[model samples]
Target chain A: MQVYVDGIGILGPGFAGWPASRAVLAGEAPWPGGETEEPSAAILPPNERRRSSALVRWAMHVAEEAIRHADHDPRALATVFASSGGETGVLDQICRSLASPERVLSPTLFHHSVHNAAAGYWGIATGAQHSSTSLSCYDSSFGSGLLEAAAYAEVEQAPVLLVAYDLPPPPSLFPARPLTAGFAVALVLCDRPSRRNLARLKFHLEDVLRDAPDTLADPGIEALRGGNPAARALPLLTAIARRRSSGVRLDYFEEQCLSIEVSPCPP
Target chain B: MVAMTGKIMAPLWISHYTVVTALGRGLDSTFAALRARRSGLRPCDFEDAGLNTYIGRVEGLEDLPITGAELMPFDCRNNRLALLGLRQDGFEEAARAAARRYGAGRIAVILGTSTSGINETEHAYRDRDQDSGVLPAAFLTRYRYTHNTFSLAHFVRSYLGLRGPAAVISTACSSSAKVFASAARFLASGLCDAAIVGGVDSLCLTTLYGFSALDLSSAGPCCPWDEARDGLSLGEAAGFALLERIARTTDSGAVALYGYGESCDGYHMSHPHPEGLGAILAMRGALARAGIKPEAIDYINLHGTATPTNDRVEDLAVNSVFGTATPCSSTKGWTGHTLGAAGITEAVIALLCLTHGFLPETLNTTRPDPALAIRVLIENQERPLGRVLSNIFGFGGNNCSLIFGGL
Candidate 1:
C-alpha cells in the first residue's frame, strides 16, 4: 500500500508557506480550504515572548502550517522532525564557550542541541499525544526520512508525520559550497486511503547518484521555495489544504528508492 | 542492489561497544553506574550558560583535545566524543584493523548525530564577525556544515584508519540506528566486509534552551515508565558498533543483528500518534525480518525517553504486540537519552544481553504504567535467553527495531 502525503507545510528563506508553496505546486484551484497567514519568522507563538533559535522559530512556523494544512486538530497528530544539522544557531553558541576555558557549553543549548529538540518543541506547542521522531541521513537525509516514514505507515497502518529541516551553518567553522541558511519544513501523514491521491512510494536499493546536483530534499517550506526533496510534500499538501473537503492525491519521492503517496480527504 | 537476496543471506553482527555519557567517559564507568543504579541525572551546571536545565554531562574534553591530534585539525567537541568513545570497549583495535585492510578507502565510518560540530563552528564565529577570504593560519577547515559531519567521518576514518564508504547518517535519534541498517545492507550487498556504525552527540546550549523552550526537559532525572516521569535529562555520548560479515566472527559472543525494521509516521510535526502505531510497525517489521516470533524474544531494550507521551504510547505499542508478559526495560535512566548515540548504545546493550542471557532493569520506574501490557523489567533479572530485541523510536515518527539472536 502506498502512503499519501495528506498535508504539508514548507517554510523557506522567506514566506510563512501556504501561499508561496501553493503557487509552486501549480495548484488547479485556490487552496481548497483557504489559508491562514502568520508572522513568518516568529519562533514562539505571537503571545509567547520566548526567544528561540533560528531553527526553532522556523520549525514552529512550519509545524503550525503543517498541523493546519493536514486539517487535523493540533492535539490529534503524531510527528517526526528530521535534520542533518539541528538548531545550528544554538550549537554555534556552545562552540564559542568551548574556545574559552572559563566559558562552557550552555546548559540550554546543550539540551536543545539534541536531534529530538524540534520534535520536543512541536509536542509542547500542540500538547499533542502523538509520538515524535527525529532523523539525520546526511546527504541522503531527505530520502532516508521519507522511506522510513512511508515504511512505518505501510506497516503500522497509521498516519505518520515527517519533517526535515536544516539551517545553513554559520561561518568560521567548517566550509561548504552550499549556503543552507534560514530554511525549515513540516509534514503530517495519516494511513487513511484516498483514490484521488498522489503517487505512492516504493523502496529499492538504488546506487547513489554521484552526478545528481543534490540527493535529498527538505520536506519543509524552505525546500519548496528552494525546490528540494522533502519539500516536494509542500505542493501536494498545499493543494489539499486549499480544498474544503475532497479526496486528493500526490506523491513524495527521494533517491528514487522510496515514495510516500498522500491522499487527503475533505474536512 | 544487494548482491544476495535469497533467504536473507546472513545475520547482522555487533562486534564493538564505546560509550561517552554523563554517567562516565567510557563503557566501564557506565556499566558501573548501571550496576549501582546510579543515575547520571544532574541539574544544568554551566553558570556562564544561556539556559538553565538538567543534563547528564561528560567531563574532561577541553585539555584532552584529540590524540593523534596531528592528523585531525579543527577540534570540535563532536570529535572529542568520538575519540573518547573509541577508547572504550577495545573499539580502537577494530578501527585500526579496518584501516589496514581497506587502505583507509574501502572501510567506511558512519556517524549518527543530532548536532554534529555546530558548537565548534559557533565558537569561531564569536571570535570573528566576518569570513575574510583568509582563514586563521592555525585554524582547521572541514568544520563547515557541508564538511564538519562528513569530515568527522574522515576524522574517524583516519583515526581508526578505515578506508571505505565513509559517510555520516545525521538522522537525528534514528541516525545511529539507521547506521546499523545501512551497514547491514552494504555487507549483505557485498559493499564492504566490515563497517563501523554508531552515533556521537555532545551536549550543547542549543539543545538545552531549545528543549527548555519546548518545555520537555525534566527538572529531575528522567524516569522511564514511571508515572511521575516528567521529561528527559539530556546527555552526551559517542557509541560505536563494529559490524562485520556475519560469517567472519570467531569470537564467543553470539551478538548479531537478526532483523531490523524502520518506518515514519507522517502524522504531525512533533508528537507521536497516541497509539504508537509507527513504533508497532517498526517492531513488527523487525520481528518479521528476523524470522523470529514475538514470543521467542526474551528481552526488549526500549527507546524510552521517559517523556510523558513516549512512555504511554510505547507502553501501548508493547502491549499491542508482545503483551505485557515479555521482559522489557528502558536504559535511558542509566544513560540520559543519548539522542543520536541512543541507537548504537542500545545496540551494544542488546548484544551484551544476548551474550549474558540476562535482562537488565528499567532504572527509575517507581511504578510501571498500569496500561503497560508487557513486563516492564523494573529490576535486573538473570535468565538464559537466545534472542533479544532493541527498539529505537526517534522524532520524525522515525521508528526502528532490531532483533538480535545467538549465533
Candidate 2:
C-alpha cells in the first residue's frame, strides 16, 4: 500500500525545524555547524514542562510541529514514537542512585524512565487518547518505525504520526555506542493522498541487501546522518525538500532494506 | 457473536507459544502451577534493594547459558530469560521450522521489553573506576548489544537466523500485547508471511527499587480484585508466540488472533483514568475489530496489577464493556505483574484455557472487591471456552486488549 507524507518535522544539531532544515537539505543554504540546545516545549503546561526531559521535549516538539503542519487534529491521529535508547539521562541517574548506598531513586525520574514516557507526556499534553506506540530497533529504529507507522495507517485507514528520535547516551556509555548528537524526525502519513500531503511515499520492503549509504552533497550532513540513526532520514527528507522524484534506501536489517519511491504531490 | 461497527481483521493462527516465568519454565509447568493456584512470588530477595515487597523472579537464569558464542555480547538477565523462553516448549525448533517453510526473509521478529539489560548498566555504574570515572571495559564492549532497548529484538533475530523486518516495542507493561497488533499490521501489509511476537523483561534493581520509589510495590503477594488489595508484586517473565496467516495453517484446532485494540489514557503518567476511559476504548475497539459483541467473550485475562487503582479502574472498564457475565480473572497473582512480559504471559494463559477447557482463577485474592460490578473468578473452573480477551495496560496510560479464539 502507498503511504502519503502529509507533513514532516526535523530537529537535530544545527537544524531547528522543517522550514530551516528544508533549505539545508535542498542545498539552498550552507550547512550551519553548531550545537543546538534542547527545545523547552513551551507549549506544554507548566507542570508537564517542569517534568519533561530532553527526550520528551524533543519528541513533543516534533509531534506538535508535524500535527500543526498537517493542520490535523492531534487527537485524530494515531502515533508511533521510535527511539534507539529511551531517556538515557534518566537511565544514568537511576543507575547512579541504585549503585549508591542510599539507593533512593527519585520517584519522578523513575516514572519518566519508562520507554514510553515521551508518548505518555504527549498524550497528557494534547489529551489525545488515540493509540500510541513507542518502539526501537538499534540502528534501524527509524526504518522500523516508518514501516510500523505506514502499516498502521494502511490498516486503520487513518492518518498516523511517526516520530523517530535518539539522544546520545551519557559519557559512561560513549565508548560502546557512540552517538555524537541527538536527532528527531517526524512524518505525518496517510493511507491515501490528501490536500495536505507534501509527497507520496511508495514504501516497500525489499529482500535484496544493500550496504551502500546515500551520499549528501555536503560531507557535514552525511556526518550528521552517520552520527545518529534518526538522522538516517536525511536522504528522504532531502528528496522531499527538493520536491524531486527519487528512491531512497534505508538500512532495515542485516539482509533487507526499506526502499521508498518518493513522488512529490503537486500543491 | 454480535456484529460490530469496525472492520473485522483476518485471523492469524497461533502456531506455537511458550512462557518462562516464576511459575516455572514452559507451558506444562505454568499450566500445572495455575491449576494448583500456586503463587510464585516470594519475599523480595533480588540484589538487596532492601524494599519490603514480593517478586516473581525466574529461577536458575544465573546458570542458564547464553544461546551462542556470538550472543555473549548480549548476555544479561533480560536476554538470558529471552533465550530461556525461546528454548522452552521446543519453541526454537518450531521457529526454525517456520523459518525454513516461509524462508528466513519472510519471517519477522517483534519483541517487547521495557528494561533491556539495564541491570548490566547498573552493575557497571556500581563498579566504575574511582580514578578516571570510567566503566569497566567489559561493560562498554557489551553496552550496545546488552543495554540498548532494541538489543532484545536484535538478539532474537540473530539467534533465530531470520532476517525479516524486526522491531522492539517498549510501551511499558502493554509493550508485548501491542506486538500482536504490529505483527498483524506487518502481515496485512504483506511485509512478512509470519511473525515471531513476544516480550522479555527481567528482574532488575532499577525496576524493583523504581517501583518501590513510586510506592507501588506490594509487601505481600498481589491479590487482584481483593477488597484489601494494597499494591502490585513486581515480576519478571519471557513469553513468545509464532503467528502465521490462518489460510496457510493446516492445523485443525489452531488458536487464532481474532482482534486487538490499543489506546492511550491521556490522563496521567503513572495513574490510570479513574473511569477507565482508555481501557473502555481498547476493549471496545478489540470487539469491534473482531466483529463481536461484549457478550460473545467467554473469558477475559484482565490487566489486574492488584494495586487498588489498577484493579478498581480495570473492574470499571470490564464492567462497562462485558458487564458481569464474562468470567474474568487476573493471573498476575500467580506470576506477579511481569510488566512488559505480562501481555504475552497472559496471552499464553488465555490460549492455554482454550486448549484445556479450563478457567484460571485470580489466585491469592481472598474476596472479590464488592464495589466492582464485574465477576472476578477466585478458583479454577472447568468449562469449554471458544473466545478469550486478554488486557494489558502500562504506565503512561498505554492500554491494549487482544482477542484470541479457536478457528
The number of the candidate with the highest lDDT is 2
Candidate 2 share of real interface contacts: 0.84
TM-score of each: 0.65, 0.98
Give lDDT per model, in order: 0.62, 0.89
Please list all clashing residue pairs in model 2, or write none if there are none: none
Each candidate's DockQ score against the native complex? Answer: 0.10, 0.68
| Candidate 1, residue A173: how far the Cα is off, in Å | 8.3
> Against the true structure, whose TM-score is highest?
2
Clashes of each: 113, 0
The 10-residue segment of model 2 chain B with minimum total lDDT is B1-10
- Where does candidate 2 stray beyond 4 Å? A206-211, A254-256, B1-5
